[model samples]
Each structure stands twice: as C-alpha cells, then as structure tokens.
Target: MHLPFWLTTALLFPVLLYQGKRARKHTPRLPEAQGSPCGQYGEGTPDIRFLVLGESTAAGVGASRHEQGLASQLALQLRERTGQTIAWHTFGVNGIRMGQLNQILASMELPQADVVLLSMGVNDTTGFTPRHRFRRQLLALREMLAPRYPGPICLLSVPPMHLFTALPSPLRQIMGWRARQLNRVYEQLARHAPGDFQYRSYPAITDVSLLASDGYHPSDKGYRAIAEVLACEDWFPDQPAP
Candidate 1:
C-alpha cells in the first residue's frame, strides 16, 4: 500500500534535507562544542565522545537554525553542568529511515563516542516502513555501535505524530495506530538491550504551537523538552540546583 503524498514527503524529508544541504546555504552549521546537560556524560577521555544519530528531530528541524537543534542544546547543557567539553556529531537527515541510517553509518567516519543518542522511528512509521525491517536495522545499528563505544546508548521514543489529524478520519486513525506500534517496538528494544543501552520515552507534546510551521517537527520549546528528559537520565546527571 502506498503512503499518501504528505506522508511520503514527511518520510523523505531527511533525505531531501541531506541532498539540498548545499542549496540551503542559509541553514546554519552545527555547533562545535558538543556538551549539554545530557551530552556531558561523555567527553575528553575514552569515555566521553558523544554522537547523536537519527532523523530530522535529532537534527533539530523545526528550530530556527542548526545551533538550536536538540544536539546543540544538549551539548551546551552538558558543558555548563560538567565544566568539561563534549564533542557532538549529528547524522540525521530529514526523512531518513532505519535502513538508510544503517547505510549512513557504514559510509561515515564517526568519532569514538562514549555515549550515543538515537532519535528515530517517526519517519519509519510515517513512511509505512515494515516493522521487520525496522527491528532488523535497529539491531544492526546496536551491534555496530556497541563494540566501538561500549557506553550508554539511548533510543528516544517517537514523538506523537499528530500531523495527520488534518487528514480524513480513517487515514488519521491508521497513521496514529502505525505510529504507536513503532513506539512500542522502540520501547521493547530499549527494555531488552544489554549493557548500558537504554530507552528514554517522553510524552509527546500535542500543542500545535510547539511544532514548526510544517506542523510536524518540534519547535525550539519542543526540542528543549526533549533535552530536559535526557538531562534527567541517570546516565546524564543534572547539575546541583543552583
């Protein structure tokens, strides 16, 4: 069954962003320092390199600029809390799926990160990607990341995909069901992964104002909420109340 045009576009958004990078000269570059409240846990030592990989949300799509994305804010928070620097890298494209992410990882030269945060699944469901494929790709990704970093690897749950609300009721129901199933897959994986690999699930904010103009991606406030959850994780401790 073919997904509708908007769903397809949403699924393919990351790829379009990646392809159009040179054309969008206006898009700001990712920040240099990588530490944030959640990101500071890994830095400097063999135990501190931080890498965030996934879709546009991981890339900070709705924010005004790249520096305002989730990865950048997390990095800044880490630096302030830890008094140590963290190097963050993002490999997120707008419409990327798990299979494509696997390919991306294979081709790219990633830093030796102590912590790896993956924000994905939203695109997969939106694209109607097969559940089997999603599971296989994610497992493969874990294997690839585990031997190298051996630290905390968190898989963020998919934020609620309410963009389809504007569609007919039937389509909306189908899309919502698909999205929930994807989130369940993520939740299950996080529960089962060995070692420090963890799953972090946050309630999806439904306030339309928190979303970008596209009515899909998270706005700055949305990204900030995501950062806050990561910060509270035991892996990424909060600074003492000032």
Candidate 2:
C-alpha cells in the first residue's frame, strides 16, 4: 500500500496544489451534529453511557437530521439489538484532526462511557498529516479516554477517499492512498490493543446516492449504513453495550 518516494513527492505535488484550490471554491459545507447533546433511548436500568467522538463524519455533517446521524442511529440500534437504554453523547467537530482530538479529549470532561465509537481519518488526510503523527495522535486519544471510558472503543476506517466524487483525479487517488495508510495504522494499533480497541473497516458503499450532496461526507442514508455496521459488529452483538 506504500507509494514510491518519487510518486509521493513528484507525482502528487502538482495535483495536490490544484485540488486545494478547487476544494476551497467548490466543496460544500455541511451542517454540524444536531439533536439533543445527550439523548436516552429504549428502556432498561443502569443505563449504558455511550460516546460518539471524532471528526465531521462522527459530527453528522451530511445527515440532515440528528436522528439520522451516527450517534443517534447507533444509540437506537443498540437499544433494539440489546435492549439497553443508552445515554448517548456526541463530541465531534466538522474539521478537527486527530491531534486536535487528542488535545481536546485531554482537556475535556467526557461521560463515563461504556462504548466509544469514533469516526476520523478523513480530516487527518485533509490536514496532510504524516502517517506516524496520525498514529501517535490516534493512540494518544485512546489513552486519554481509557481511564474515563474503560470499555471497548470501535475505531472506524477513514471512509474511502477513492469514492469521493467531490475530489477530482490524481488527488482522489493520492488521498485514497493516504486514507489506506491511515487505516493500516489503525488496524495495527487495534491488533495489539485487543479488548480495549477494535478496528472497524469502512463498510463497502454500494450506492453513490448514499453520499451527502457534498459528495465528501455521508448522507443520511450513509449514516444509517454506518450505524447498521457498527451495531452489528460481532464484538458487541449480544453483549451489554459497554
């Protein structure tokens, strides 16, 4: 999955510049995470506290309704799947990178979460972060939250950059390559982290219609698709959501 040195520097340079210019003028800004900051769903005792953390995708940019977003969808699905009332909270910003997330989590007070679902990587690629730095920041984020949310953390693969219709040409391929690299780092981290971490691969997106109008983020249908995959992961299928 590694790109050659020449391709990294020479081939991608000019394209990167062109893409940046196009993005500034053409990329549409989507709405932020909506709905109540914290929501309760289903019925059970000892409620399960769930946290949704990460960048735009986790923030629910493309989805028109808060209920259509990942946090709410996951909360509702978990109730249906396991019958536990979920105290769901979403902490996501549209354009934050991994390093910023690490810094933010380090300073903030997070809910005592039973399960933490994260969606990032896209912003890391957008920020042109080196692979090692991205990995370090990601792990740092997990470590920062470990003490407060001592439960399983599901780290989603960066959505497929190759599929972004908004981004043109070689830039798409380059971003796609970088996105894969980021996912590899996440996968490697999860392998060693075991019970504390689980790497969730980006689900295969079949319908282009599922993408938001911006074509960079997930549409409401897209978020539902993501929530479905997260809810059905074998790791948490029948267990207490934590």
Candidate 3:
C-alpha cells in the first residue's frame, strides 16, 4: 500500500539526500554535447526541418558522436519514412531545467520547423521542479514550439527511473515516483491539448547494457534504438510507419 505523501516524503528525505551525493559520485564524467553541426543530412526535394530541443538527451550526452545519437538516428529514419530531405537540429545543455529552457527560447529567434521532437523531464525531476510548475513550464514550451512547427509537437515521456541501475535504493524509488507523476501530467496534455501536442510514448528502456557507463544516460546503441522506435511512430495521420 502507498503511504501518505507527507509520511513518505518525511521517511525518504534523509536517505534520499545522502543518495544524491552517491549518485553524483558514481556518475562518469559526461561526454561533450553531440548536438552541434546538428544532424543535417538526408538529400531529397522538399526539405523538412526537424528540431530537437530540451535537456541532455536532446543534446546527446551519453552517445559518443552526434551521428550515433538520437537526433541523427531520428533524422535518418525520418528521411527514409518521408523520402524527403531532413535537416535536424538539436539545442540543449546537459543540466538545463524547464524554466531555463523557457528563458532561452524567449530570447532567441525560434527556427522554423515542420516537425518538432523533444526530450525533457528527468532533469526537472532531479532539479526539484514542482509538479504544477513543471506542467506550466511544459505548456509554455509547447506554446513556443507549436507555432514554429504548427504541425506536430511530440513530447517524449519521462523515463522510468525506478528501474535505473545507477540510482541507489530510496533515490530510485523517489525519482521513480517523481517520473511517474510527471508522466501523468504529460499524458493529460496529450489527451487534452488544444492542438497537436502529442505525448509520444517512448518505449521503456530497462537494459542497463544499453545505457552509458554512467548508468543514467542512453548509450550510442540506446540512442539509436530510441530513434528507430520514434521513426516508426506515425507522427502524421497518413504517414507510413517505418
């Protein structure tokens, strides 16, 4: 049976606070961002501008090269699916929070895009963003990206943190709860968002081997796997599956 929120938080607080230090100690020094020169490939008529925004996953921390990262994998697959050129760009830092992202976008010239894909939330969970604030920032993000793409804005679900091999005991449990709670908010938006905000349900990644040595971020193989799965999803009504 689930304990009351107050009781649960009180019980877990001290242990979780210590585990946070442990998590940092165990994590490997992250690789450089693999988003620059962003995956601009695939040649055909009618170029489709694809934008990937948000967090380290979008910036591709674990993967060694951008080509092996999610952005490139998705870009290649999109090219195959559409039989059109795809120019994909990824913009994000390793530890960005939602509010930071919101501020960043507000100051920049939002690029035009036919399709916009996103990866966020895990950091938000770790960064201590409240659920309601997360929802608000997420909605604000969508509002900003919606008009740029004006076609489909797909938000990938928060990963299942409870299962991560990297996190210790109560930390995993606590983070998992946070991830699940945030996921519920995302799902609600997918169902109710006025326009084409889709909560793309990314497959659950449980295999530790596919993850980076840090045991947190996706490895090259993991990024490729995720990208392949995303490419297969019918992002458009009549678009054929890969």
Candidate 4:
C-alpha cells in the first residue's frame, strides 16, 4: 500500500501484465539445491544454532547442493569467524510468500536456534503484496519465532530487482521500485523493534556472472559473497568469538 507502488501499478498495469507472462514463459524452472537441509560446521558442540527460512533463495535454488547454498556458506563463514561449532538448518519452499510461511511453521515441529536469518521479499514483491499486509505477516512471523529462538531475528533486505538481468526493462524497473519500497518498511520495523528485530541490506548483484542460469537467483559465488558479508556482521558483539 505504498503510494508509489499503487501509482506505478495503475500506470503500467497492462505492460506489467504482458511482461510478467513473457518472463514466466521464458524463465527456466531451476530445482532447489540438493542434500540434507540441516548440518553442523567446525568442531566442538554447536554453541551457535543458525536457521534460514524463506523462499527459493533460502532453499538454495541456484546451487547444486546444500553445502554450496546460502545457509551452508553462512554457517561455514560463521564457524571460521567465531572459531566455534555452528549448526545450521534451512526450510525453503520455492515460490512461497510470507503469509504461507505461517501455515508451514504451525505444522512443523521445529528446533531451537540461537539466531535466525529470514530470506524473503522477492515473491512478495512479485506478487504485489500490499505493504501493510507484508508488514503484518513479518511481525506475525517474528512473534511466532521469538519465544522459541530466544535470540536475534535478522531479516535480509529484498534484492533490488532492477539489477536483475533476467527481467525485461519496465518490468525490472517496477519490481525494483517495489522492492525498495518494501525494504523501507523493513527498515522502519527493525528500527522500532530495537533488540527484537534486525534488518541487513543485501549486497547488490550487478554483474550477470553473479546470477544463476535463470538470471534471477544468486549463483554459488553470489551466495558465498552474501554469506561472507553476513557472517562478518556484529550480531554477537556481546558473545565475542573465542
């Protein structure tokens, strides 16, 4: 319900509709990364439990296996930086939106984690979810996870779609605009929540080489770059690396 999004959609509804169909028809459907969704890194009993939950990117669509995916790469990076055992788990569903995640979480018997990473926004952006609804679902998700996790809940900012090589011109432009708007909402929510919520801006992927074959999701190298940046964040200033 951001004003810009409404205005853009109103002006470009037809072009957006046509381009959306064309993009879907041309884009290849890549499978999620293979292998177990949960694993541990480094030595010693896991002192840090990390969980990644969200859409295709969280599910590791572009990578060949879980090891090469975002969650795994992040776990490896954290293990290296902290020199402590890190346990990581991911639950990613292709093309799923934030509201749908609530149902999934309610159904599953999840594990306790020390830190949570949420990868979302792409699908919501594409689906044209109203800003108010997106914010509500996000707050609800945080409420559901906070009591169980008892740690920081970091939400990764939605990628800038205008930079995506796969999407056609106007479509990419509109998507990017929407993405920026949604990210603004994320920043506001995080600002208000203080210790309860955190938002991390994504490193822009401008190079085509950083994208996967479909030109949408991140390639292994892209995931690695993202993980490196995230793992280095001062999320655990109080619990310094030992």
How many clashes show up per model? Answer: 15, 0, 0, 1
Tens digits of lDDT, candidate 3, 88-158: 77776688888998999888886666777778888898866777898898878877766565764678889
**lDDT tens digits by residue: candidate 2, 1-242:** 24583367466688788787888688888788667666779765536677889988767898876778888887887777777677678888889988888888787887767778888888788667888888777777767777777765788888778767678877887778778778888888889987677887757575878888877777888888878877776544446553
Candidate 2 residues lying further than 4 Å off, grouped into runs, are: 1-6, 44-47, 235-242
Instruction: Pull out the clashing pairs in model 2.
Output: none
lDDT of 3 at 210: 81
TM-score of predicted model 3?
0.91
What tens digits encode model 4's per-residue C-alpha lDDT throughout 130-231? 889999998888888876876657889999888887999899999999898888888998899867678987689877777889988889998998899887
- Candidate 2 has its poorest 10 consecutive residues by lDDT at 233-242
lDDT score for residue 118 of model 1: 90
Give the best candidate by lDDT.
4
- Candidate number with greatest TM-score: 4
RMSD of each: 7.6, 2.6, 2.4, 1.5
- Better candidate number, 3 or 4, judged by lDDT: 4
Give the Å shift of residue 146 in candidate 3.
4.0
- Model 3, position 181, has a per-residue lDDT of 83
Candidate 1, overall lDDT?
0.66
Question: Worst ten-residue run, lDDT, model 4?
Answer: 233-242
Task: Order the numbered candidates by TM-score, best leading.
Answer: 4, 3, 2, 1
